[model samples]
Target: MLNAITITQIYVPDQDQALDFYVGKLGFEVTNDMQFGPMRWLTVALPGQPDRALLLEKPGPPSMSEETAAQVRELITKGAAGGHLFFRCDDAYKTHAELKAKGVEITEEPVDQPYGIDFGLRDPFGNHIRIAQMKLG
Candidate 1:
């Protein structure tokens, strides 16, 4: 039976740069970093959440042909690959300030919503990300 999600993947043109952005800028921790023949299996997780990891995949061999990989890469660069991630934070405004001070791109300022306060940002690879602080009932 289905239980929990283990991992989610997003394609990047360069693994090292993605690693730096996710870990260095966003404070994610490396869950795995190893090689599988020509492929590098790299994964990361939020500081205390190791049960689920985000795979920083490269668009290349072992998955698709070079021609297809090139097309994927092009789409990713244009931010049309449909990659997105949503995150919950303890404090939306604070998190936004912290990330902005770290030089992370701030695509939107925090705004109050029916659910909570939320904001958006884009990863270096053009993947859209939204972070929010929710109110408890």
Candidate 2:
């Protein structure tokens, strides 16, 4: 049986830009950055979480047809291609301020929700990310 999720992939138009956004801005650490033939293997993980990671990939042929890749590209540009990534933070308000100060694009400011205080943002590739602080039960 599978024990845990190791890596999740998010397609991007450019890996270099994604790297800068995730590592330079979001404060994730680089787990791997190497070129395998025509494809580059780029992965990042949170500084405190070493097991799970996110892979920054480029849409292309072989795995997806050229037409399909183009469609995905368009969707990504429209911010409707991928699912949101939810992150649990200690303080949503503070995190939002810090990320915003660092030039990260925040789509929504922190607000109280039934579950917690949360905020939303988009990665450079247009992937949605929601950070929240869970209320103690």
Candidate 3:
């Protein structure tokens, strides 16, 4: 039986730059950094959550055709392909400020919603990220 999600992948144009953004800016810790044949197994995890990880993948061969890969690259560039990551934080406003100060491209300011106080930002490759603090009821 599947107990939990171990890894989820997000494609990027460059792994090194993604690594820098995730590790240097977002403060994700590097879990794995090894080469696996043609692909580099680069994964990052939020601090204290070592079991779950995000795989920073490059858009290229072995899985998709060249044409499809090209289209994916275009979509990612336009911020349409890569899906979003939602994170639960202690304080959404504070987190947003920290990320903004770190030069993260915040697309939305923190606002109260049905769920919580939330804000949005984008990774260098245009992947959307949401940080939220749930309302206690």
Candidate 4:
């Protein structure tokens, strides 16, 4: 039986920059840093959360098809289109401000939703992304 998906791979141009975003801005816990030859394997997870992790690694040779390159670059540039992290918070308004104070980009402001508060932004690498805090009954 498959228990769960443990990690996700995100292609980035700069490993350090991505680390800063996932760690410094998003407050994810660092897991491992392994370097072998020209490859570096760094993984991080959210505090108190370990079932999933973010894999920061370089993309394939740029010589790949322009279309594929465009898609990867788009994922890197805008943030993961399908990446959504849920944060449990007391106040979404304060969370938004805190992120702004950290110089984190706020591509969209918080808006009330049937399920909760949803707003999100991109890391410097452009992974389509968001953070949400679900509302109560």
Candidate 5:
């Protein structure tokens, strides 16, 4: 990043369920889960990759204006996001194949970029997740 990878926020219906899926299934670690009034701030980070954290929270917070929250909720409901939030993979090709074989909803096939190789997968919650491997220089 231009500075550093912080938390990539994701809105979820249930934070506990999200933790079960991302943490229990995908092997992410629970970094932060705390409450401040009616809202809770939850974050998860990968073990091997900890530079960034994933924020799991529901819609609505004093931080966001009602109009902005409404727009974000609309985007989340429509399932049309700007781009994907990627997950690093050791072998992008094989991982993509295995995921496809397991009936995971894949958005795109592997594409080789100048800096890396990656493929996109859609989570159950409509979050586009990219799995990439760095291309050798």
Candidate 6:
């Protein structure tokens, strides 16, 4: 039975840049960084959450043909790759301000919702991310 999600993958054009953005900008910690033949396995997880990690994968070679990889890269750059991440924070306003101060792009300002406060942003690779401070039951 599938009990827990272990890892999720998002295609990135460059692993190093993605690493810097996810770690340096978003404050995610590196969970794994190793090379396997032509592929580099890189993963990052939020602090204190190593049970689930996000794989910063490059769409190429072992995964797909060069032609297909090129197409995927184009789609990713256009923000049409459909890569999205949703995160929960203790304080959405504070988190948004902190990320903005770090020079991370803020696509939307925090706004209150029925669920709580939330905002949207984009990763360097055009992946959409939303952070929220959810209301507790």
Of the pair 1 and 4, which is ahead by lDDT?
1
Candidate 2 lDDT, 1-137, residue by residue in tens: 98999999889989999989989998999999998666788899999786899988888855688899899999998999965788998988889999999999899989999999999999987899999999999
What TM-score, over all chains together, does every model reach? Answer: 0.97, 0.94, 0.95, 0.79, 0.74, 0.97
Output the better candidate (2/5) by TM-score: 2
lDDT minimum window of 10 residues, candidate 3: 57-66
Ranking, lDDT, top scorer first: 6, 1, 3, 2, 5, 4
- Over the stretch 21-127, how does candidate 5's per-residue lDDT look in tens digits? 67865678988889978789889899966668888877777667668777776776567744357777889888887776755778889999887998887666666
How displaced is residue 88 in candidate 4, in Å?
A: 5.2
Q: After superposition, how far is residue 125 of candidate 1 from its true place, in Å?
A: 1.0
Best-to-worst ranking by TM-score:
6, 1, 3, 2, 4, 5
TM-score (C-alpha) between model 5 and the true structure: 0.74
lDDT per residue (tens digit) for residues 26-114 in model 3: 99999999988777889999999989999998887766777998989889889899568888999888888889899999999999999
Off by over 4 Å in 6: none
Error of 6 at 113 (Å): 0.9
Q: What's the lDDT for residue 17 in model 1?
A: 97
Quote the positional error of residue 30 for candidate 4 in Å. Answer: 1.3
Candidate 1 versus truth, CA RMSD in Å, comes to: 0.8
lDDT of 4 by residue, 1-137 (tens): 98898987767768898888989987888887897555778889988777788887666443456577667776656555444544567777888899999999898999998889878777787765666778777
Against the true structure, whose lDDT is highest? 6
lDDT tens digits, residue span 98-131, model 6: 9999999999999999999999999998989999
TM-score of candidate 2 against the unseen true structure: 0.94
Instruction: Tell me the spans in candidate 1 whose CA falls farther than 4 Å from its real position.
Output: none
